[model samples]
Structures are given as structure tokens and as C-alpha cells.
Target: MRRARRTSGKAQRREVRRLAAASADPALHFLLLLPLALLHLSGRAHADLAAYGLVEALLRRLGPAAGWLLAAGLMAGLLWAIGRIRRRRLAWRGGLLLAAFEGVLWGLLLGPLLQLCLRLVSLPVAPLSVPGSAGALHGILAVAAGAGLYEELLFRAALLSACAALFARLPGLRGRDRLLSLGLAVLVTAALFSAAHALGDPQALEGPVFVYRFLAGGLLGVLYLARGLAVVAYAHATYDAVVMLWSSPA
Candidate 1:
């Protein structure tokens, strides 16, 4: 009985370690957010997705039920392919709970702190109108959630990595200066991330707004490097949700 207990305990500990690793992986982040793909198909709560555009013709042609299944499958397949590339196994339940907890923890904490910094510098801080044109409360939430997942994938996971590699190849940055390379990468990406708002609407490129997004983007970039996609995405989504709710009419 004692030997059996020891074996069981060892197995449990190993499982815990694996779960911890998987929870912090970008590939697992997609699996964790996989349900959002299904949720979006209800056609009530809408989110902006690049994949949705690719699947739009299918959606228009098929019956609602068929469209949902086809789209869900395609989304799942893409996630699975990415997961295989990253070598992540599914570690749901525990990882998901941790993701949500971290989201709530970091979201509320970082958001207000960013605002406090803005206030200190007297750079007009206001509640969201987040990227705008989301319309309605649900729409705003959807956009936040979409931005959290897709934007993080684009800016943090893809562009950040690309920038780091590019910086490493640059003249003065080529030598043992990892910190400088990372710093430059983060700054450039943060700038681009902030400026991306102009793509949604040119008029939103106000001075204060740019600064606000730049700060927010920098936070997200750092957090992504530290914690991984799940945490930063959820944190960003949660903060935007809070902002949108607070800003919307009663």
C-alpha cells in the first residue's frame, strides 16, 4: 500500500508539472479559446475574425446548422495544426480555471495602473470606445474578445518574435545584447500595435489615444513574454470588457 501510494503521488506530481507547462503555452491558448469559435456562430454575439472572412461565403451558402459545424471544424483544425507545430497537449479544466483567474487578476490590476500613469502625465484617460464600431454592449465585448485573441496572435506571438529575430540581425544589435534587441523589438511592436487603431478609423489617431494604446500595448507585449498568450489575451479582453461596460449608456 505504501509503495502504491508513492507511485500515485509521483504520477500526480508529473501530471501537475505537465499541466503547468501546457497552461503557459500559446498553442494551448487557442484550444482554451476554441469555444469562442462555436459561440460566434450563433450569429447573435458577433466577433471580428480573419478566418470568418475566409469562411464567409460558406456561411452565406449553407444552412445555419451546417455552417456552424463546418466553421467550427475549420477553426478546430487550424488550432490543432498549430498545437502540433508547438507540441502542446490538451490540458483543459485546470488550465482554463487558472487562465480565467489570471485574466481577472491581471486585467483589473494592469488596466487601472495604466490609467494612473496616464493621469500622472495628464494624458486624457477615458473609458473605452474600444477600437469603436462594435455597437451595443455584446458587440463591444465580442470585439474585445476578438482583439484579445487575434491581436495577441498577430502582434505578440507573430510580430514580437519576428521583430526579435530582425533586431538580432541588425548592425549594432547583432552582438551579445539580447536585452537591447528585446527592448527595441518590444518598442517597435508596441508602436505598431498602438498605431493599428488608425486602421479601424483614421480619426482615432489622437495624441492621447495613441499614448494610451502604446502603453497598453507595451504592457501586453511584456506580459506575453512573461506569462504567455492565454494570460495576456484574457487580461486584455477582460480589461476591454470592463472599459466597454463602464463606458456604455445605462
Candidate 2:
């Protein structure tokens, strides 16, 4: 009996260690990713601070297709990483369904509703009237496809999973760990999403309009949790598609 008890204790300890190593620490993960996200998103503004040459230099290091390809790679990696945790049966279907649902929600509901609300406030409207130009069409497509695959993969799939894993490790947080993890992931990802946009245009911020992006971030977070990352990405893509299609000439 004594020997058996000792073996059991050892086994338990080993399992705990495994869990800890595998656990997702949202704050830690966010810190790790924050710098990278800023650097990537601020590629434009950074260009002004001697970072412009760096951006160009980096891009120049690769072929013209590299940026798009890098985005594609991120999408692929996200799917693969998420698949590691997701049940096999629902992987593809779930992602597709999510994408579809998000597309409808953003295009038919959220985007329009927000537009109306903003209009009431006399904000300059993004017509989303039509595909403005070929480049715009391409950008829209990129955002849509990127949102569906890359965004979901990064924010929803990877980040959420990491949080869940971390939550499982802390004994004190056991009962509500998963929920806590999810919330942290959403908040961090949303912040990054907002920051990513904020780093752009420079003139992008004025009045209270910037709040829209934050709200959109929350929506995206909820979408990922309820529907899956793919759905949010789809919604994101559709929204971009419309905006690009209708954007005024530069």
C-alpha cells in the first residue's frame, strides 16, 4: 500500500507539471505578441521614423508576393495550430460555418447598423457603395480572406487556446479558469486589433469616431468565442470588401 501510494503521488506530480508547461498565460502571451503586433501593424508609420527604410528593406528582401504569402502562411499556421486542439470532425466545417455566419452578421447587420448610427452623429460615412478600383478590390479581398483565416487563426484560435491552457494550470483559478482565459484573450486581441488600426493613417483618429474600432473589436471577440475564428474573419473580410469597393480615389 505504501509503495502504491508513492507511485500514485509521483504520477500526479508529473501530470501537474505537464499541465503547467502546456498552460496558457494570457498576459504573458500578450506581452510576447504585443511587440511583434505593433511592429507589423505600424509598418507604415514606422517608415517615417527611419523605420520606413526598414519596412522597405524587409520587403525588398523578399519577392513582391511575400507579404501576401506571409499572410497566407499565418492563416495556414493558425488553422494547423487550432486543429491540434479542435476535434477532428468539426475542424473544417466549423471554420467555414463560422466564416459564413460572421460574413452575414457584419455585412447585413453590424456594419449597416453602425453606419446608420455614425451617420446620425454626422460622421463622414464610408460609402461601401461599390468596389472603388482594382487595387481596392484586391485589398478588400485580402482583408476578407485574411480576416477569415489569419485573424481568426491568430486572435481567436491561437490566443484563446493559449489562454485556456494557461488557465488550467493555476489551481486557484480552476473553477472559472476557462472563462477567465477566454475573456483575457478577447480583450488582449481586441486591444491589439484597435492598436493595429490606430497605428495606421495618422489622421485616422479624430473626434470620438475611433471608438467604432474598439466596439468592432469586442464584436469580433464575441464572434470568435460563439461561432469560431473563421466566422469573425469572414465578417471582417466582407466589411473590408465593401469599404474597398466603395472607397474614393486617392
Candidate 3:
């Protein structure tokens, strides 16, 4: 009985390790973000989110009922794929739980750290734009999730991946030089990440805020590389949620 229990314990540990490792997979990031995307699609009030305009245009072109059918089909396909992953990796759950803890804990820690750094230069920090109305609270969470998921997909997954791939192809950057290449890619993407904010919110482009975002982007770039997209996305979203929902001026 002792040997049997020991064998079972070892197996459980191995399963836990495997599930933890699977959180880094982009597949899980997609799984985490998909429901949020669908939520944005379902409600016209959530219309403030990105790409809803494009999808809405599609609905107009295809007819509203037809557009929904298409959306349903796509959702079904995505869910089926996620189900396969669930069976393979324990529902890709490790990071999902860990993300909440990371989001809340890091969100609390990051603000003071950034403020201390900025205060050295005697510059006042810019507040992240958050709606103050009681009803806008839900909107705050939705926007945070959208921003985190979308920005990570754009800046980290697509842009950073492209930059890293480009560096890998350059001569004399082979072998352990991969780290150097990745470092460069992170810088390239972090710069773009900061700059991209200018396209959305005017406040984001202000001097103090821009610098804040650049620094934050750099940290997120490193975090994304280490923890993968799901962890980083949740961290970003939760940080924003903390700032907005908790009434903290980050």
C-alpha cells in the first residue's frame, strides 16, 4: 500500500508540472481570451471594443441573422479546438488560476514602483484613463481585458515574433546569440508597444504617461517572454482593473 501511494503521488506531481508548463502555450492564451471576445461581440454596449465595428459592418453586409450564424459557427469551431486541448493539458488551467493572483498582486506592487522611479526626475505621473461613473465599472473590466488580450496578440505575439524571427535569420546571431536576438526583439516591440498607445487615447501620448508606458512595456515584454501570453495578458488587464476599479491612480 505504501508503494502504491508513493507511485500515485509521483504521478500527481508529474501531472501538475505538465499542466503548469502548458500555460505558456499560446493555445491557452487564445482559450482565455476567446470568451471575452465573444462577450464584446454579443453586446452593442460593449461596442466600445476594437474590431466590433468591423464585425458590425460584416453583420450589416451579411444581414444580422446571417452574421450571427457565422459567429456561432466560428465559436463552435474554437470551442471544439479548446476541448481537444483540455483533454490533453488538463483544460490549460494552471495559468488561469495563477493569473488572478498575479494580476492582483502585481497590480498592487507595480504602481508604487513606477511612481518612485518617476519621482526621481520630479515629473508627475499621468493617470491611466478610467471612467468614474458607477455604471462604467463593468466597462472598465471589459476594456482592460480587450486591451490586454489584443495588445499582447499584436505587440508580443505578432510583432515581437516577427522581429525575433528576423533576427534569428541574420548572420552571426546563431546558437547562444539567440538570447541577444530576443533582447533586441523585446526592445523593438516594447518601443512599438508604447508608441501604439498614441493611436487610441490622447492621454497615453503625454510625456510622463508615454515614458511610464515605455517602462511598463519593457517589463511586460520580459514577463511575456518568461511567463507566456496568458499570464502577461491577465497581469496587464488586472493592473488596469486595479487602477480603474479600485480607484487607484496608476
Give the top-scoring candidate (TM-score): 1
Per-residue error for 162 in candidate 3, Å, reads 1.3
Error of 3 at 183 (Å): 1.5
lDDT of 3 at 71: 68
Task: Tell me each candidate's TM-score.
Answer: 0.73, 0.49, 0.72
Worst 10 residues of 3 by lDDT: 127-136
Q: Candidate 2 on 1-250: residue-level lDDT in tens?
A: 9999999999998765544332222222222232233433433222222222334576778989878976787666666655553533323333333335445566556577666666777776543222112354344454344433445555567765676577667686776747777676677766665555544444335444455554566677777676544345556556755665556366
Give the distance in Å from residue 29's predicted Cα in candidate 1 to where it truly belongs. Answer: 1.7
- By lDDT, who's the top model here? 1
Predicted candidate 1 versus true structure: per-residue lDDT over 1-250, tens digit per residue: 9999999999999988877766775555666565543334433345655424435655667767875787688677776757664565546567667776786689888778888979988988844346544557667767677766667778888899899999999887788679788888889998998887776656547888888888888888888888887788788778877887777678
**Whole-model lDDT per candidate:** 0.73, 0.51, 0.68
| Candidate 1 steric clashes | 0
Worst 10 residues of 1 by lDDT: 36-45
Q: How far off is residue 128 in model 2, in Å? A: 11
Model 3 agreement with the true structure over 1-250: per-residue lDDT tens digits? 9999999999999877776766555556666666555543344363353423444576688775876797698788678757867676553566556554564566566677677767876878765553222236566667666666666777887788899998888877765567888899999887887776666577777788877877777777887888777677777777766776667333
Q: On a 0 to 1 TM-score scale, where does candidate 1 land against the true structure? A: 0.73
TM-score of 2: 0.49
